[model samples]
Target: MIPDPSAPAPTVRRKPLLAVLLAPLFMALIAVSVINVALTAIGEGLGADSSGLQWVLSGYALAFGVLLVPAGRIGDATGRRRMLIIGIGIFTLGSLLSGLAPNVEVLNISRILQGVGSGLLNPQSVGLIQQHFRGQARARAFAALATTVAVATAVGPVIGGLLIQLLGPELGWRWMFLMNVPIGIAAIIGAFKLIPDDRVRTRTRPDLDPVGAGLLTLAILGIMLPFLERGASVLVWLSLPAGLIVLGLWWAWEQRYKRAGRPPMVDTAIFSQQAFRNGIVIISVYFLGATSIWIIVPLFLQMHLGHTALEASLMGLPSSIAAAFSSQLGGRHVLRLGRKMVIVGFGIAFVGLLCTTILAGFVDAGWVAFWWLAVPLTLMGLSQGLTISPNQTLTLNSVDPRFGGVAGGILQLGQRTGAAVGTAMIPGIIFSLTEGGHSWLEAFTIAMVIIMALTLVAMGVAFADRARETSAPGAL
Candidate 1:
C-alpha cells in the first residue's frame, strides 16, 4: 500500500497553538497560589498545624526547585512537547491525590509529587517558547504568558475562596485540585494536536546524574524543613547545619563533575556572565518580595481584619489586574530602556509595599483601607509584571542555547526557592514578633520593614546590573 501523501498535517494555527501551549502552564501557575487561601481549611480538614501548613506549600516548591535542572535536561534529551504532556498528566494525578489526601502527611507527599510534575513541565513551557517563537512573536507570547500567570496568581485566591464558601470545608478544598481535571485534559488534547514537536540533536543516551540529584534534593529538603517546622526547635536546629553541609558538598561535587567533563546538576559556567548571575539574584529577590506579599497580605486580611477567604481573595484583584497589563508593557520597553526596568520596578514595588505596610496598620471595613491596599498592590503587580519577564528573557538570552534548559531551570529554582523561604520565614517573623504582644499592627509593621529591606537589596542588585552593563563591551 502506498502512503497517503495527501493527508493533512495537523493544522495548528499560530493563535490556537499559543493558547494550547500556554494554557496548561498557566494553570500550573494558578495552582501555585490557589492553595494560599485554602491553607487554613486544608489544615483544618487534614488535621495539620502551622508547620504542616508550611510543608504543604513549601514541599511542592522545594521538590520543584530540586528537580528543575534534571527535568529540563530530560526535556532536551527526549522531546519538549512529549515530556510536557507526561509531566502535566503526572501533575494532574498528583493534584487529585492531594485533594483526596486523608491526612497531612499524605497531602504533603502528594504536593511533592505535584512539584515533581511541575519540575518536569515548567521548564518545558519556557523551552517551547524559546524553540517556537522569535523576535516580536516571542515577545508577544511572553507577554501573554506573563498575563496568564498574573491572572492565575490573582484569581486563584478568589476561586479557592468561592469554592470553599460554596462547597464548604469538606468538598470545597478538593475542588481546588479537582478543578485541574478539565484544564489538564484540554491541555493534553491541545498538546497532541496543536504543539509542534521540537527535539534536540542527540548522539547517545544522556547520563542521569543520580548522585547529584540526590544531594541537591537532600540539601533543599534540609534547608526547607527547618523553616517549615518553625515552632519545633529541634527540627530547625538539625535541619540548618545539615542543609548547609549537604549544600557545600553538592557544590564541591558539581565543581569536580565539571572538571571531569560530565553534566553537573547546574553548569557553573553560566555564572561567568555578569548579567546572568545578577539576573538570577534579582529574580530571587523579586520573588521574595512578591511571594511575601501574597503570604502576609492574605493572612492579615483573614486573621487580623476578620475577613472571609472570599473577601481576602477579592482584595487581591487590583494588583493582579495591574500586573497582567504591566508585564506586556514592560516587554515593549525592555530593549529601549535596558535593565533599568529592574530598578524602576523595585522602586515602585518598594513604595507600594511601604504604603501597604502603613495601610495595614489602620485597616478597617471601608473604602479607605481598600483603596490604600489596592493602590500599592496594583503598583506591586505592575512592578512585577515589568521586572519578571524582562529579567527572565535577559537571563536566558545571555546564555548559550545549548545550555538554555539548565539556565532556565536554575532561574526557576531561584524563584521557587525564594518563594519557599519567603513563605516559611514570614509566618515565623509574624509569630515571633507577636509572641507577647497583642498588637497585630505592630507585628505587621515589623514584617513589612523586613520585606521592604529585602526589596531595597533587590533594587541595589538592579543598579549593579546597570553599572555592569555600562562597563561591558556593548555601549549605548
Candidate 2:
C-alpha cells in the first residue's frame, strides 16, 4: 500500500489548517501561564514548599527549552505530521500523569514530559506555516498564532480560577492539567486528516546530527540548571562556566560538522542573519521580563493580599483581551510598519510595568489597587499584541523555508529559556525578600524594577536593530 511520491498534494483549506495548527499551540501557551494561579493550591494539596512549586513551572520550561532545536531539526528531516502527532500524544499523556500524580515529585516529572511534547510540536507548526503560506497570508497566519498566545495568556488564569472556585482548590488545580486530554486527542486526529504530507524528498538518509544535539542539550542544561535551582546548592554555579565551555565546543563542532558536508542541529550560519539574531535577543529579554509579570502578580494577589485564585486571575483579564484584539491589528500592520511597531510596543509595555509598580508602592487598599492595576495591564496587553507577532514576522522573514523548523525552534527556545529563568528568578527574588522580613509589596516592587529593567534592555536591542535596518536597508 505504498503511496505515490509524485502524486499532487491535496489542497489545504486555510481555516481547517489554522484551527489544527493553533489548537496545540493554544494548549502549550496556556500551560505556561495557567499554572501560576494554581501553584498555591498545588503546594497546599501536595505539602510542597516554594522551591517545589517553582520547579513545577521551571522544570516544564527547562525541558521545553532544551528539546526545541532538536525537535525542530528532527521534524524538518522527518515528517512534521508524524512528529506533531507524536508530540501531542506525549503531551496528552503528561497531562493525564499530572492530573493523577500522587505527589509533587511526580508532578514535576509529568510537567517535564509535557514540556518535551510542546517542544516537539511547536517548531513543526512554524515550519508548516513557513512552508505553506507566503506574503500577507503568512503574516495573518502568524497573527493567528499571536492571537492564540494572547487568549491563552489571558484566559488561563480565569479558567484555572473558575475551576478552583467551582470544584474547590484541591480538586480544581488537578483538572487544569487534566482538561488538556480531550483537546490534545482531538488535535492529533485533526492533524492526520487536514495536514498535508510535507516530508522532504531526499536521495540519502536524513542526518539528525545526534552528536551535536547531545552537546547542545548538555550545554543548555548546564546554563539553565543554576537559574532554576537558584543556588539551592552552591556547586550548581560551577555548571555555568562549564555550560559555556560546552556551548563553545558545540559551536565549533557545528562548524566542523557543516564543513564535513553534513547538517548540524542548528546551521550556525542562521545566527549570521541580523534580523534573526536580533529577534532572538529581543524576544528572549522580553520574555525574561514579561512572563514573570503573570507569575508574580498572581502570587502576590493570592499569597500576599489573601485574594482568591479567581480574583487574582481577573487582574490580568483585561490585558489579555486587549492583547488578543491588538495582535490581530498588529498582524495586519506588521509588514507595513516593520520594527517601528515592535519598538513602540516595547515602549508601551515598559511604561505599563513602571506604572503598575508605582501603584503597588503607593496603594494600600486591596480592591482599589486591583481596579487601578487594570489600566496598566491593558496597556501591557496592547504592547504585547504589537510586539510578539510583528517581531516574529520580521525575524523569520529572512530564514530559508527549508530550515524554518530549526529557526522557529531557535526563536522559541529564546522565549522558553527566558521564561524559565524569569519564572524562577523573579519569584525567587520576591520569596527570598519575604523570607528576609520584607513586605510582599516591597519585594514585588523590587521585582517589578527588575522586570522593567529587562523591558528596557529589550527596547534598547529593538532600537539598535531598527538602526541597523535603517543604516543598511537590507541588513535585516
Candidate 3:
C-alpha cells in the first residue's frame, strides 16, 4: 500500500514522544560500532592474543545474530513493549557485568548477554513505528530511525576514544560498558510511560515458535563458530558447510511449519518480494565493506601510525560528521527516488572504498599526511548514511504488518551477520599478511584490496535489479 509520490504525508499524532522508544535502540547501535575502537585497549588490558581479541569483538554479534529471529518471534507473538523493557533490563545487567569482568572470557559472556538483550529490544523499534504511523509519516519515522543509527555509527569511535582517554586504556573500556547503565534505565522508564501497549490492542495470541527458534539458533551458531574460532582446524573448516546444511534444514522445517498453520520463526512468504530480498542482500554486502572500516581503520592508525586511541579517533571525525549530515539531509531522496537512492549510495561507498584501498596500498605509514584520510572517511560516512536508511525504507515497505517484528529481526540478522563475518574474515586476512612477515601497511593494503573487490561484486548484483515502492501497516 505505498502511497503515490504526489500524495501528502500522513500525520504522526505523538511524534515527539518517540525519543524514549528510540533510546535503547540508539544506544545499542552505538555500542556495535564503538567496540571496534576499544579493541586494542581491551586486548592489552586483558592480555588477550589475536584470536582472543577477535572473539572479544565477534562474540557479541555471535549471540546477537543468533538470537534475533527468535526474539522477533517472541516480540511478535507475545508483547513488543514488554519485550523491549525486558531487553533493556537484560542489557543493563550485561553492561554492569562487562564493567566488572576480570577476565576476557567473562567479558565475552557479558557481551553475549548484552547481545541477547539487544536482539530482544531491536525488533520492537520497527514494530512500534509501524504501529503508530502510516504512509509518508511512516517513511519519515524510518528515516529518523536511520538518522539515529547513522549518528551512532559516526560518533562511535569518538565516544570510545573519549572514554578510553578519560578512564585510561586499561580502565576506560570498562566505562564504555558501564555508561550504558544509566541510559538504559532512562530508556526503560521512558518506554514504560510513553510507548503504548500495542500487544494488548491485538487479540492474536502468538505462540512461541520454539522448534523454529532452536533450529535457527543452531544454524547461526554453526555458521559463526568456524569464523569466530580461529586456527586451521578440521572442525573450524567443517562448521561453515555444516551450518549451511542446517540452514537448508531450517528452511525446509519452516515451510512445513507454515503449512501446518503454526507460528513460524520467519514467514517464508516474505522472502518472495524481490525488493525485500535484494535489500537484505545489499544491506549485508554493504556492511561487510563499510563496517570493516570502523574496525580496521582504528587498528591501522593505532598500530601502524603509533597514534593513541583519542588521537586516532580524531581522524575519524570527518567521516562521522559527514554521516550525521547525510542521514538527515541526503536520505530524503528515498521517498522521491525509491530504491535508486540505494544505487547512488552504493556508488559513493564503492568510490570511498576504492580511495581507501589506494591509500592503504600506497601511503607511507609514518607519513604525517594524516589529513589525506579525511576525504575517504567522509565519503564512507556519506555512503553509509545514504545507504542504510533508504535501504531499510525500501525493504520494510512491502512486508505485512504481522511479520514486522520478524522482518526487523531478519534485518538485524543480515547486518550483524555481515559485521560478524567481515570482522572475523577481514582481520584474519590482515593478520595473516603480517604473519607472513609483510609490513603492517602492506598487510592492511592487501586486505583493503579484497574489500574493494567484494564491493564491486555487490554493485553488480544491485545494478541488475530495481526495487518496487510499497507501504506496509501495523498489525497491533
Candidate 4:
C-alpha cells in the first residue's frame, strides 16, 4: 500500500500541548490544598472566626462548582483557546487580590474569583486534549493530568508548611497566593501561542440557551448550598428541594429546546450514551469515596492525635507519590485493558481500605499506627492512579470532539458534586461519632466502611458496563 504524500502531517505536539494545558490546573489544585495548611495564619491575619475561615474554603468551592457547566457550554460554542486564556487571567488577578487582602471578606471574595477562574479553564483543558489527541496519546495526556493532580494534592501541604516555617505565618500564607502570579502569567502567555485556535466555524450560529443556563444555575446553587453551609441554618436545607425542582425544570426545558431543533445548554441525549453515563457514575462515586481520605486522615493525625501539621502531611506523601507514578503507568495500559483496569483498581482500593480500617482499629494511636497506615495508603494511591485517568479516558471516548467542552464540564460537575457530598458526610460522620463517645479509631473505622461502600458501588457500575459491552459487542 502506498502512503498518500498529500495528507497533512499530525500537527499535535503532545508534550508542549500538555505542559500548556496542565500548568493552570497545577496552580488551581495547589490553591485548593495549600489553603488548608494556611487557614490558621489567614484567620489570625484577617481577624477571622471559624465561620469566616469556612467561607474562604466554601466560597471557592461554590463558585467553582457553579461555573463549570456554563463555562464549558460557552467554551464549546466559542473558541476554547480564548476561554482558557481569559480564565487564567482572571485566576491570576484573583490570586493577587487574595495575597493583598486586608480583611477576611476580601479574601473570601478573592477565593471565589479564583474558583471561577479554575472552573472556566478546567473543561477547556480536557476538551483541547480530546480534540487534538487520539488513541494512546489521549490516554497518556489524561495520565499526565492525573499525575499533576497527585503531585499537587501531595505537595500542597508540604509547600504551605515549608513557607510558613521559613517565613513565619503572616507572610507565608500571603506568598502562597502570590506564588501563582508569575506561573499564571507564563501559562497565559503559553496558552496564547501553543493552544491551537481550531474551532470550526459554521454558517448557522450556535444557540447558547440562556434560559436553560439560568435554570441550571438555580438548581446547582440550590443543591450545593446546603452542603456548603452545613451548620449555618436549618433553612438552608430548603435549598436542596428547590435545587431539585429547578433541575427538573431544566430537564424539561432542555428536552423541549432539543425537540424544537434548537441547541440546548446541554444536549439531553448525551446522557443516553452508556459510556458517558457509566463513566460519570464511576468517577463521581470514586471521588465520593476517595477524596475524603485527604480530609479525615489529616484531622485524625493532627487535630486528634496531636501530630505537627507538617508531620501529618508527610505521612500521606508516600501515597501521593505512588499515585503520581502509577497514574502514568495506568495511562499507558488503559487502552488495552479498558474497564477491567478500573475494576481491578477498585478491588485493590477496597483491600487497601479494609487494611487501613483494620490497622487503625487494632493498632494503638501513635507513630506506630501512622507508619502502618502508610502501607495501605500507598496501595490506595496506586489504585487511584489506575482508576481516575482510565475512567476519564473511557468516559469521554464516546463523545464527539465538538462537544468535548460541554461533556468535560458535565463530567467534572458530577465529580465536584460527589466530592462535596462525600466530604461533608464522611467528615461529619467522624466528628459525630467521636462526639457521641466513640473513639477516634472507631469513628475512623466507620467512615472507612462508608468509603469502601462507595468504592464498591463504583466497582459494581464498572462491572455492569463491562458486561454490557461484552454482551452487545459495540454498545459502548
Would you list the C-alpha lDDT of every candidate in the order shown? 0.77, 0.87, 0.76, 0.88
Model 3 agreement with the true structure over 1-476: per-residue lDDT tens digits: 32221122245335754687678888888777788678888988988878777766667777778878888777766667788899889989999998888889898889888988888888887876766666666677777787777677667778898888788998889988898999999998888777655453345555577787888898998887776676648967787888889899989989999899986788788999777788788888877766777667767877777767666667667777777777665445666766666677778887887787677644554343765777887888787677787777767777876667788889878888787688778888888888899988888777787787767666665665452333321210
True-vs-predicted CA distance for residue 426, candidate 3, Å: 1.9
Which 10 consecutive positions of candidate 4 have the poorest summed lDDT?
1-10
TM-score of each: 0.90, 0.93, 0.89, 0.96
Tens digits of per-residue lDDT, candidate 4, 377-402, equal: 89988998999999999899888877
As for candidate 4, its clashing pairs are none
Predicted candidate 1 versus true structure: per-residue lDDT over 1-476, tens digit per residue: 32221121244366787787678777787778788778878878878888788778777877777778777767755567788898889888888898889999998999888888888888887776666665556666777887888899888878888888899987888899988878888889989888765544457766656677788778877876665554658846698789889988988888888899887766777788888889899988867756877777767777777767677677778888998888898777765666787788888888898888877766643446544677778888888887888787766767665555667787888887787678777767887777877477788788888889998998899888888777863621
| Candidate 4 local Cα displacement, residue 48, angstroms | 0.2
Rate residue 291 of model 1 by lDDT. 81
Candidate achieving the largest lDDT: 4
Indicate whether candidate 1 or candidate 3 has the larger lDDT: 1
Clashes of each: 0, 0, 1, 0
lDDT, candidate 3, at 200? 38
- C-alpha-based local distance difference test score of model 4: 0.88
Name the regions of candidate 1 deviating beyond 4 angstroms.
Answer: 1-14, 43-54, 102-105, 199-203, 364-367, 473-476
Positional deviation of 37 in candidate 3, in angstroms? Answer: 3.7
